[model samples]
Target: MAATASRSASPNTPGQQLFQALRRDTVGGALLLLAAAVALIWANSPASAEYFAIRDIELGYEPWHLRLSIGQWAADGLLAVFFFLVGIELKAEFTRGDLRRLRTAVVPIAAAAGGVLVPALICAAFLLTRPELLRGWAIPTATDIAFAVAVLAIVGSHLPKALRLFLLTLAAVDDLLAITIIAIFYTETIAVLPLAAALGVVIVYGLIASRFRRFFVDRAWAAWVVLLPLGLAAWALMHASGVHATIAGVLLGFTIPAVVGRASNRTTDADLGPSSQGGDGSGIDLAEALEHRIRPLSAGFAVPVFAFFAAGVDIGGSHGLAAAFTHPLTYGIMAALIVGKPVGILASTWLATRFTAGLDPSLRWADLTGVGLLAGIGFTVSLLVAELSFTAGSVEHDVAKVAVLSASLLSAAIAAFILTLRNAHHRRESQE
Candidate 1:
């Protein structure tokens, strides 16, 4: 019985198990799915209006001398945390990941630039003709990393490891573009006093953190308690100052120490292979201490919370889907993420590698092209962009949500299909 059980054991493979766990657990992804399910059920239910009325419920606080609004406040306020984590990720990627140096960074950086610029152009070309939709230009410029990663992860053995990494790089680049546009173009008016106050607070935080060796000293924990409130104050200041509150996240994220993992053990050989006879220092240094402190917390809490709040959308199914795909704003977004991303990324990376970086001949153009298509799968940050594309409570805002959902899901599916087919073809050719 033991032998039979061992032979026929249906235990999930590690990757498969990880995939299932991630799918079930991602705070926003799970909630988005649940919310989507509820939306579908409600839309079909007799109480459809009741389901949508939830979108209108007053969740604001207007007590004492302060009279604050709710809907946009909740959406924007909650999403600021999302941007905060994004700020951390963008910095971490550039400081330590593939973008660490020129030699290792060519294909991904070029591809990312193409992915971002092409989508913006496509959105602009279509929407610029229509003044009403012009405000939503940033919608198409963003990509959702989870949906893209989820697509690749689901395809499993079909995708090459290199291709997966390529997609990740492109997604990172896509994020940078979306964040930049949000900070630079989408903001209202700059309120100076609050901006200055926010700057002052950031400086103070930096000083306190540096003086205390917050990254290394265990005693610094108590002082670190001040971070959230300070961050909140900064965000409020930014909000008051006319700059998008999201930029405050970027500013704060830079002050974070970049290293969390040891460079030596980052590889598989270090973890599973033999330990060295000699040691390299205490192994628990300041950089690792900082990363050890920040990464898990950021990954587990900050990121998922952001995803849940930012990703929720009311897809009306057939009608909703139709409106999302057909509307000018929707069409522009669809075209950019689907059509322009792959093409632009491929062209840019090829040009950079061939004429500039001079990559290895073995890294064929087809390989890069396949990877480029995979990068167009932008999900998380794109949804946030959709929220900003229109003023709160407007019909355009609702339409923008539908468009983000439709375009993200569609592009993710299409990119996966294309890449899987390409990978299959490449494997067959190699086998021959």
Candidate 2:
């Protein structure tokens, strides 16, 4: 029994750190909300023209052909870094978290599928004849993970803990789908020269990581240093590659050295060497390492920064209530996010579980329904997609932004309502 027992003494340390990082103050969730609120307030002020001008103004400089222009550059380029971090998140979830097992992933994946399909179909039905708007179908399928979680935090204890997790996982899967779609659908044309160069840097970086791992290098930081900048370089190259610049994030994320840490044990050989590459005092737990390395950067810094830029739509502008509400693209987008999202998610998840594959037994439809409504709040990715879905200054783009912001706020309200109601039910059941 003594031999069978093992101890890490602090296995939960990483999870605890991540939990703290994601809270109202730590992840900048509160600040993000404040910034967003202030931005809207300022944008609506008489100095609102200055707000738009600032967002449009180019800042920064680039030497050695490395462009560092701000405004859209900060907006689009830095966001590529944000997406790269998201890719890391998606990879980690599949490798270790709720997505690690088919049984666990089933409910959320199905729900996410339903959420995405319904909104897209809603958009199609509303705008199919105007092929111009068809491209933006993907805009409504995402839920802003940070903002949604922040919303829950503000609403106090009325929401169930289980529902919060369920909503988060569902949104994670939704993010995964959105990443795939961005990679597959939005690519423009192959500009071979820059792409070829980006490929070289990535391959070289991977080889370096593999070599270091094979040789048992303990400094995981080295791997990330190479991986992140190389990813940025890839984004720069891909900008000219006819690919949507964001896809670079996904590609780079897949390649990151998600290699886990080896467990320590007194019995293991002190220096097992390259022949037993996974040996430390124990063996590799690749999932743990990936979570440790990437989660901090993504959840703490990258995601928050990304939100600051993407969520800063000029709502305080000359958008008269009619201009905002009457736009077909606006209303269509609203319905797609608010109405179509939950309904579609419910329907598809139902279909998947009943006829094809079933949801995880741990989850219930009512639980999923609450999550589905939250999934309707598509703030982050919706805004990102709007940038791609429309050219600058077009009516399509303006209306889409207003629609996304409006729908997301409404969805948040609806989800909160449902969650509170569900909590009441849970209390009743427990009492019974």
In terms of lDDT, the best-performing candidate is 2
Tens digits of per-residue lDDT for model 2 on 1-432?
224322322224665445445534224455555555666666667887876676766554444244533446654565565566556666666764656777666866788887887887788777877877888888887877776776666553544565666677777778768866776677666778877887776676556544555332344565457555766677777766666666676666655455443444332111111221244423443323444455555556565555555555555346554677876788678999989888987886777677656565545677667667777778778887887788755777767877887898888888778767766777676679
**In model 2, what lDDT does residue 289 have?**
42
Query: How much does candidate 1 score in TM-score?
Result: 0.74
Clashing pairs in 2: 114-345, 115-345, 188-242, 189-242, 260-285, 260-286, 262-283, 263-282, 263-283, 353-358
**Candidate 1, which ten residues in sequence have the lowest lDDT sum?**
267-276
Query: Against the hidden reference, what TM-scores do the models get?
Result: 0.74, 0.78
| lDDT by residue for model 1 (102-164), tens | 766776777788778887888889888789888877777765554455556655354456666
Strongest candidate by TM-score: 2
Error of 2 at 299 (Å): 4.6
lDDT scores of the candidates, listed in order: 0.59, 0.65
The number of clashing residue pairs in model 2 is 10
